[model samples]
Target: RKPKTLLAGVSGRARPGRVLAIMGPSGSGKTTLLNSLAAQMDKAPGLVLQGEVYVNGEICNQSMASMRKGYVRQEDTFYSQMTVRETLRFVARLKLSPEVPYEDKMAVVESLIKKFSLAKCADTIIG
Candidate 1:
């Protein structure tokens, strides 16, 4: 068995006040690259991920990146019993700062629903 190279010579910079979109066809390693950058990539036998990743001009490792960033996959794996709004509220509570008021947090969740046009299904169960 030989180790496969999922990514090689991949380099890019994401600067403040700008957007960096990773676009590609399916199975084009977009997820792999994001996982590596977010330090969420799992270590598997015979899988070698070698690269230097930096955040805000400093070298980023798992601990450092985990502290400063969050990653969400493109799939919805929320609790099937929870409604869309409920799921968003749950996530907002976990991710938002403690100083953020409950009302504000809920407001944030509402904004997300509207932003993504999920209001129609906001109260619908994920199931």
Candidate 2:
């Protein structure tokens, strides 16, 4: 039996300084397409993913691609009791370079909160 294809014949380009949004109904292969583009799709048994993903016009291979891309799922998972600020802070601490100073990390977090207009709920529980 052949495995089902989660994505088919999808193609596009994302240029620098330009924002791209993927919108579709549930189960419409939106996540699948993003995962394929980011090269983060799960390697499940009997699953085969085909097609090429390119970055800056270069093919995005394991060694050639920098793992700096971020993917936020439709259903975000975080500590329900932790405030948004705390959640962002924790993620920054974990994902940011160790050489990045504490103040710089905090500054980045603050910038992100402001940029995303998250200040209204920065101290509210993520849930």
Best by TM-score: 2
Model 2, residue 85: distance off in Å is: 5.7
Tens-digit lDDT string for candidate 2 (3-71): 687877777876666778998899898877876766656733555677677777777788755666666
List the lowest-lDDT window of 10 residues for candidate 2. 39-48
Top-lDDT structure, candidate number: 1
Clashes of each: 0, 0
Cα misplacement distance, residue 56 of candidate 1 (Å):
3.7
RMSD (CA, Å), each prediction: 6.7, 5.4
lDDT of 1: 0.83
Worst 10 residues of 1 by lDDT: 39-48
* Number of backbone clashes in candidate 1: 0
1-127 per-residue lDDT for model 1 (tens digits) = 6667898888887776576789999989998888788666673344556868877677876677657554578776699999999999999999999999999999999999999999899999998
TM-score (C-alpha) between model 1 and the true structure:
0.56
